[model samples]
Target chain A: MLGYTLRRILQMIPVLLGATFIIYALTFLMPGDPIAALTGERPLPEATVAQIRQAYHLDDPFFVQYGNYILGVFRGDFGIDFFGRPVLDLILERLPVTFALAVTAWGLKLVIGLVIGVYGGLRAGKAADHFALVFTVLFMGIPGFVIALGGQTYFGVHLGWVDPAGIRAGWPMAFILPALVMALEAAAGLARLTRTSLVDVLRAEYLRTAKAKGLSPQRIIWGHALRNAMIPVVTYLGLSLAGMLGGAVIIEAIFNLPGIGGLMVASINNKEGTVVVGIATLLVLVYLVFNLLVDLTYGLIDPRVRI
Target chain B: MTQLLEVRDLRVQFSTAQGTATAINGVNLSLEHGQSLGILGESGSGKSVTARTIMGLLDMPPAKINGGEILLEGEDLLTATAKRRRQLTGPVMSMVFQDALSALNPVHPVGRQIGELYRVHRGYSRKAAKAAAIEMMDRVRIPAAASRVNDYPHQFSGGMRQRIVIAMALALDPQLLIADEPTTALDVTVQAQILELLKEQQAENNMGLILITHDISVVREVTDQVAVMYAGRIVEQGPTAHVLGDPRHPYTLGLSQSVANEDLKGRRLPAIEGSPPDLLALPRGCSFANRCPLADEQCSSSAPPLESVGAGRTSACFHSGKVASNVAYSN
Candidate 1:
């Protein structure tokens, strides 16, 4: 197991390098010069532009610039944005809000998805199951931005159940509504996946053996069936965790939450390449880590899974 | 004493997209305590269904017991409340399935699965259950039961897994053990060992055993009495020796003749002609008529009733005498 973990960690190096290169390349390829855009209609003098560009190594070829950036990253340097604030510090400040938002959304999806899934799976073809089917389809069909904007209007504006916009209230109060909207699509997909996986597990021959062993329905379903069913669901959940963290940009923008997502969007618009690359790198790290954790969790849930 | 189990006119039907198929039609069976009965049949012969129905493991709606009385120790299981039936499952009766790999829950440790019976039925503490699990494992002759207890079902070999399944079924010392093709998935050499283990356990517990199998040799080796089923109905039933030695039903005779033997080496073994009838659209007469060599016009016109042919023997055929003479001449 230790050897496996070491190997997996080693494998992440190439993936991280690849992801960083892609983000850096995309940032480098963005239309409009950051230096020229900074001056904004009042073009910077040629000498000042040269000085700034030289200091940042902006005139270097793409691969050379990427190599320099990677070296800086290895030494814990993410460079400064156009506003002179360290990109790492900028991301760190907003990291908590995004982390909290993503986690809240994740928790919401896990709970809602499992409840609906287990309920529907056990009572398949019944009214509740049909309702779950329709509910999942409805949520899955609508785009996330639509749900966010619609939810913001109905609940935040008309119903007056929440603040219409912004995170001035802070913490849970500000995060809940947008997180819920963010959770819906994933929760629906998860419910469908969980339902199908659970239904398949319930029909497995082991469940019959469990029943024939004289286990109660509750024990049989929860004990014998749920763990096996959860194997696939856990993989989905882990992938979605990475997705929620990176994909919360629209939700954060709609709710005006000062999270990394909103920061990324603002930085992208302002042509702050450093901030965008920094946040993308963090997301890549998070994706790799969560995937590893999911693999580890498999061994815990199923004894047959060695690692 | 009341028979260990009694099934009187038990009928099971399955509703499918195609149609309602009578899987077990007018089947009757009885077993005395400590005796072994082999229910011999091919795939879709409803032998497995009969075992599952008796165990109360059949899924309703798709499967329905149209009419039957499954009596366990003189108490009709058909009329028993769900809760009562559940109560009887572990202590009164239990079942071992065909494929041990699929039958044993893969995620759980083998010990916990076997221990579950004690934990749920006997109210044993987790530690006590673990200890009991090891004990059960040892009884099944799994090597190093203590160490292997923590291993999952997939960790064990096919034969070892079946033993674990048998251990779980016998955990509470149920009066009856229904082994549904328990050795079917095992290696040829391992098959004999599993059968031997089952027989040993049955004798030690004095448990009524229903060994369901398609293998004639397995039946002859393990069971005292044998019932031959065709198209969901029992066509011949008697002492295993008598039934296998002198089959009264043509279907039974065909089944016996099909078995490969030393004498039949290098010769084309005579196989029963035609497949079993489609249950969804069964003919009004004997379901096996199409496949039976001795099938006459009368055999196709009317279904034969199960009737006494000899001491403790019953044959469902209009020409049992003819079949017996044929068997005698062949021998």
Candidate 2:
């Protein structure tokens, strides 16, 4: 098990490098001189521009500049952004808020999806199954921002449930609307996955034995069927960390929450390459860690999966 | 002897997009305590369906019980409430399946799988259930039951896994145990061992055992009574020795001929001609009429009822007497 984990960690290095390299390369394609954008309207002297370019190694070849950035990332030295503030520090400050939204959304998604999915699976080809099918299709087709905007319009501005936009720190209520919108799409996908997996599991031969043993339908489903069904659901949920992060970008924008996703968009517009690259690197690392955790959990859930 | 189970005119049909197909036709069967009955049939002859319907395990939308009276000790199970049937399942009756590997849950320990009955029905604590499960593993002759109880289904060999299935079935001391081709998925040597285990366990528990198999030799070895099924109906049923020794129906006679004999190896082996009739479009007269060499105009015109042929035997053939005399003369 330890050897497997070590190998996975080793495999993650090249992927991280590739991801950071892509983010670094994308910055160059942003169609503007980042230094001029940083100075913005108050045009700086040519000497000052030269000085700034030299200090940041902007005068070097593209490959050389990327190499320096990679080294700086390894040293935890993400360079200054357009505002001359450390990109790493800025990202770190927003990390907690994004984490809160993501976790809440994910937790809700799993709980709701599993319950509804199991119901649909148990009653496959019946009323509950049809209802779940229609519900999933509707939710999955609609965008999270539409749901967010609708929620804010109805529950926020009209009903005075909370603010129409923006979030307050340490306030659980402020997190509700955005988290719910983010969770809707994820929950729909998970429910569909869960329903399909469980429907298959219910048809397995072991389930026949379970039924023949005189086990209550309830026990048979929860005990034998769900345990086996959970493998695929776990796989989807683990991989969904990346998906939730993407959703959070749209969700954070809609609600005006100060999360890493919101920060990312602002950085993208300003052509702050350091901030974009730094956040992208951190996301890749989070993705790798989540995948590792999922693999380990597979061993715990299913004895057939050897460490 | 007390009747443990009885099925009267039980019919099961599967409704499909094409049409409804009869899986089991007007079948009648009964079992007494401490007796072993073998249901012998080829594939699609409703052997497994009979067992599943008896267990109340068939899903009802695709599968519908058109008509039936499944009685457990004179209690009609078909009309019984779901709760009542469920209550009787583990304690009164249980079933073992054909494929041992698929029958056992791959994720859970074999012992826990066995112990599930005790935990759910008897309300035993987890530790207590584990101990009882180990005892059952020992009873089924699994080596190192104490340690091996924690092992998963894939960890055990085929024969050993079948033994585990038997252990689970016998755990609740059910009055009736249905083994649907229990040894079908095993090797010849392993098949014999699993059969032996089942026979021993049945004898010990004094349970009514219904062993379903296509192998005539398996039925000969393990059962006291035997029923030969042809196209969802029992064509011949009586004592196993009597039925095999003197088959009255052409279908049963045909089945007996297919059993390979070492002495007849150099010659052409006798085989029944034609395939089983299609279930969706069976002839009004008899399903097996086309396949029977002895089938005459009367056989094709109308189906023959299962009639008593004296000596506690029944045969569903109009020329049963003629077939019997000819078979007796040959023997």
TM-score of chain A of each: 0.97, 0.96
**Per-residue lDDT of candidate 2, residues A63-111 (tens digit):** 9999999898889898887567898889899988888888888888888
Interface RMSD of each: 0.9, 0.9
- How well does candidate 2 score on lDDT at residue A42? 95
DockQ of candidate 1 relative to the true structure: 0.84
- Residue-wise lDDT of candidate 1 within A201-276, one digit each (tens)? 9899999998998888899988989989998898889889988998787788888888998899888988888889
- Model 1 chain B lowest lDDT segment of ten: B322-331
Candidate 2 residue pairs that clash: none
On lDDT, the leading prediction is 1
